[model samples]
Target: MTIQENRERPERSGGEQSAAEPSPPDAGGSPAIAVEGLRKQFGSGPEAVTAVEDVSFSVERGSVVGLLGPNGAGKTTTIKSILGMVLSDEGSVRIHGIDVYDEPRRAYAHVDAMLEGARNDYWRLTVRENLRYFSTIGGVDPDSIADRHERLLDKLDLADAADQPVRSLSRGMKQKVSLASVLASEADVVFLDEPTLGLDVESSLTLRRELRRIVAERNLTVVVSSHDMDVIEDICDRVVIMNEGRVIADDSVENLLHGFDARGYRVTSADLDETVVADLRDRFEVTEIERSGDRTRVEVATDSDGFYALTAFLRSRDVTLDAVETVDWDLEDVFVELTRREER
Candidate 1:
């Protein structure tokens, strides 16, 4: 389907039948963030560039929703507009039913965000000091600050580095600190942009695990923007994919996979001939056919019944089939196919 077509469909109600039913509010569980017909433009007159166009989606309270797209697809612009960093020319943004533009303070009162490359500390301050300072500014009680600090430091695996200065920490370490500050606030909703960018594999895994734990334990709403499909698939319950300033797809991971409905099979045989290849192609979409010396490899797209038919055909022809197995497609494959269809 086209990008416009996909956006026109109703957002999934997270297995709910009615929009009015009492449920957990936002993406996670509560209704934390609701956006409708949001639009933003960068310049005026002939130089104007449209950043986002008619984007609409709701994030439940306490769920992790992923914003995914290629570069220049307006993911960042949508995020900034919601955070009041960039103003939207048209449309509405609501945080827990409070309109952001109408009541910025009240709307963002329970929200905390970690923007991409956001610097959150004084260079000379120690890690513990930075958390303490943020807590003070955030109006966290003095009595609870120490307890919160120790919990975050330990949870983020930053306890050992708590005494070190912010400027002396590695990039991953800095990111962990920034995340700690956000969590320490115990904000109802959290926006994280590229949280695992530039981290090594181990650090990325660690961060993902911590994020999962935080969301599950605290029931906090989370809206995350990232190009990392694995992160999205792993951490987010649903994903909203955008391209050219418009939402292309918004569905659970399973539904998105179901949409493709393409199944593949790999077949290996000996002494395969042109007639056999032609016959298989007539029955199924041939994805690949490779012949190395005497052994041949054949890959085809077919559902269960078609697969059975192909096997029966080969047996009827007395073809020596060595092996057969189903081929599984990942989220990346579905993403490319859907996006390419939209582009066309």
Candidate 2:
């Protein structure tokens, strides 16, 4: 579809809206990363294990895309293939229009990765020493290296620990240092594999914020492989969920949440009878019913119009609902619903 056409479409439930409109190509400005019909299989003959199958997607420039899946779902394999660490049996991966297999050096020129425990600095070196070492290796100009070191140290809140050895740093600090190394390289595309794996709540939040900022300010394309639903929902503009080496869902987080179309209402009343419960169940997915003393609490799922119908049904039966509270859907619910559907 054309860019203008894509921009005018109204949002809709399910994949109908998004799948119908594939993103337009960048034309002269190629996408930061693109994978087409990517397939990977380990070993040969009957003993082979297919790790990735027919995966196709593109990361828009400056966009933060989340790569999500359950354990052993080929996320790592796909990432490794993109980085040219592993060769795909079929399909192609391009970084800034340079085919990874055809020209590994050129394709990797725009790419930088920080897989879990990625060693970008020496443990025995001081933080300042590590920065200087990476800067020189990355070929930063002498004047610019000094400027970048000061900026990175201050921005990542590592100035206080600048003189400490890398081994003495906390997990969060190390993560920050790793991220700083990537930023220091001035690469256009970055892959962060479980960036917040061992971080505490506050550290995770900080890392996520920094990632978003870097992507926005630098116009950097980033692929974050993470299991944290909250992190994906908060930072990602879109997500690609894979299962058993195949992509099951590829859409914006908003679209995923809306696709489920499951909304709930909590109703409190003096008492409820079996007949009333049966009547409500006929029209809605009754998730829960709790009773305590004189009050009865019922949780029912219904769409906007269905909710109105439910209220009318209750009124007709002379059941006075003391309070009705609406509950909005969230990413966790959407994730569970989609993953469950895929399983079946």
- Quick one: RMSD of model 2? 11.0
Candidate 2 per-residue lDDT over residues 205-317, each given as its tens digit: 87777777778888888899887889989999999988889888889988887775547788999857878888888877999999888888899887777888888888888
Q: Over 4 Å off in model 2, which ranges?
A: 1-27, 142-148, 268-298, 301-319
Q: In angstroms, how far off is 114's CA in candidate 1?
A: 1.2
Looking at model 1, residue 204 earns an lDDT score of 80
Candidate 1 regions with alpha-carbon error over 4 angstroms: 1-30, 142-145, 268-319
Each model's TM-score? 0.79, 0.79
Whole-model lDDT, candidate 2? 0.75
Candidate 1 TM-score versus the reference? 0.79
In terms of lDDT, the best-performing candidate is 1
**Which stretch of 10 consecutive residues in model 2 shows the poorest summed lDDT?**
10-19
